[model samples]
Target: MQLAIGISACLLGQKVRYDGGHKASEFCLSQLQPYVRYQAVCPENAIGLGTPRPAIRLMKKTQGDIHLVQVSDASIDHTDAMHQFTEQALPAMSALAGFIVCAKSPSCGMERVRLFNEQGHQLGKAGVGLFTRQLMQRYPWLPVEEDGRLHDPMLWENFITRIFACHDYQQLCREGFSVGALVAFHSRYKFLVMAHSPSAYRELGRLVAQAKLFEPEELKQRYLQDLMHALKQACSRKTHANVLQHLQGFFKKHLSSKERQELSSLIDRFRLGHLPLMAPITLLLHHLSRFEHPYLAAQTYLQPFPEALGLRG
Candidate 1:
């Protein structure tokens, strides 16, 4: 629904890379465009390094400090400048639901940007890009993903779901936070959270149960942190199967024994990887539409992101 996302300009097809090339993601253009309004920024451009400029690299010193240095001149560094830009950018990105960064770039890669020694020898692919490192540290609750990683189904789905969940939390801030609201929000996301981290599922439930004991702002802060952290852990087929079984229990009175058997079979096929998650989810939704199970119907696990994105598929 036009959720605003902060994205690397290059990933959105802007020519902001050092060589003036873009690292546009096909799914972002074809599937996500309609649902999200992107605020594209090129950290290199923001730091006054215009497009077509010389490449920069992360220099890892023996003492373990990494600096964004010019390829030819290690003495020339942009680390501080990128940090200053991040200081300004993050505060202004309150509306952003997530960030999509360029991979293996000095300015925007989320991880594994190559680190080099002073002699220009490759140290390792261990450096997080300058700008993205700050972007994440400053807002650890925010969903940050590299464009390259989005090609994987699990990572893609996790990142997409986290963003939508973050947006929901942000919306609660707009709608006014209350104990009842927080509980309802947590309730809808119960299975979704459990699928990601059962420990977090338990922790968040305890937090919400005692939500009234904490100040409103404190409750919001803690709940949001726990929610995002839980989602950062990827879901397993076992967990999805558990969640599917939980959903199945809701339709017991309504479904005939044959229908129940079919539902269980679909869930098993999905758990075995023979069918996509959508198979069992589709069957569940069919029951959801005709059934009067309000709680099951309200669960976001059944429909996390827009189905058109096909992150699950």
Candidate 2:
């Protein structure tokens, strides 16, 4: 329920830039702020680069090159500066269960920052924000998304759910793995796994049932790893189809024939990409309360956080 969300200063409507402009995200403020504690950080401003500073771009290199240098004062390496800030921020970042980064920043971009040649012509989206890369490398399981993707309900829901899961996993690690924790965790993710890989879910269940025989320490590590792995495998479209179909079966008795047929047709359209997973998933989640049991409903699954963080502008 409590989460630490690292967000871009601009997204929070802060005038931290050199130019004194803000790119505020109303949704983040109204929705997410109420759910968790937010820690805002702008790397450009943090590194003593004031707002309205000369716009920095990533200089492209010819093939077989992997050099990352500052756009201005190429000779004055800023790599160390980035490293220094990451080191300083590590302690502050350790407790955060998730992050929301600004997409496409040279120092903060998570993925697909624009690469340019010497002349600043468009090359390709190849580079990651220096700090973003470091954060991922340090905490592989932490949920991190770009602010843009949060606009989509599916992506937004996925990110928050994943953050909670990661936070819960860390707690499990602290308290030690037990049959109760394992059962509860499995229940939360059961339908989700069914969508991705039913076989893997079964295998994981078997593992959890047998966890009693192994050393407690070993069980903790093995279970957490397997649990995360199951979630990873469960993220595909094919898996989602399986889960939705199963959920549909549960609702047949409750829904009228016409409604059943309409829902089935929508599911089919979703399979063909005529509709996004959100449309059906949204309806299912709303009705999930009817099922009572958390595991049997289709609302319990989560998507990987990285896919949710987006910056289109």
Candidate 3:
């Protein structure tokens, strides 16, 4: 099945913004739209706020007390209504692999949204959007990103990697849960976990080792939470180089001195930032195809997402 993703309606070119204009993302529209199914949401619109409605802002009433209110008139609060809508909407969104939310929106921003004091003074950017906060609190494992942050290549790649991984796990769950299947899933993602965090890699290994002790539901929740948390760490060039070298060990017996030197050179060049990640990865994949190592072939690290996305470059 194609992966399902939750996205802000405006990002999908829907004119659902407060001003009756859309914050359409070309990347989401032209590039990512083809690969996955999108579930578009407009929280403000869902809560009976009509098009061209009065804009809203998050106002801090006291410590741990914030309200979503009209920007021009603070007394018109929508926090309760937004909460009610989110409580109703999120249950249906449990199947989504990821979410893309508009940045700096009072209703949908993921982080650093503008906050206001009672006197109308700027309280700096420290608030999370009302709807998004609940969405995260309910489903901490789901991959969520702000639309603007996707412009950064590293963040973009990381988010894509996460959603694909999430979808893989979701598929595994749908196939039915088993300890052996869980182990196989972890085996496929072993190198990927190591690339992001060596410590998490080891921890996850122990978790899977003791999987039989926990109930199946508990095991699924714990494994997914830990796995998603580990993936959130960005893999550095240094880390990628290390993983590449580890992968090189698999082909050591199959390669000639010349072939080994060539692969090592490509990895070294990539580590020094002279080449994109795809350079060494391509070489590794080529070697894997020729050598036919079942372990290496099973790994998702080799091709995390659809190659057509060209995200590695």
lDDT at 30, model 2: 76
Cα lDDT of model 2 by residue, 190-245, tens digit: 77666657887898889878878888777776766565555544255667777788
TM-score of each: 0.95, 0.70, 0.98
Highest-lDDT candidate: 3
Q: Model 1: what TM-score? A: 0.95
Off by over 4 Å in 2: 59-70, 116-123, 152-154, 171-176, 196-203, 206-238, 244-313
lDDT for each of the candidates? 0.89, 0.70, 0.94
Q: Compute the lDDT of residue 19 as modeled in candidate 3.
A: 89
Query: Model 1 has how many clashing residue pairs?
Result: 0
Model 2 poorest 10 in a row by lDDT: 304-313
For residues 1-313, write the lDDT of model 1, one tens digit per residue: 4688999888888888899888889968877788889999998899899779988999988888899999989999998998899898888886788999889998888888899998999988988988888888888888999888988878888899999999988898778899999988998999999999989999999999889899999898889989999999999888999999999999999999999999999999999999988899999999988887889888999999887776775
What value does the lDDT take at residue 54 in candidate 3?
Answer: 90
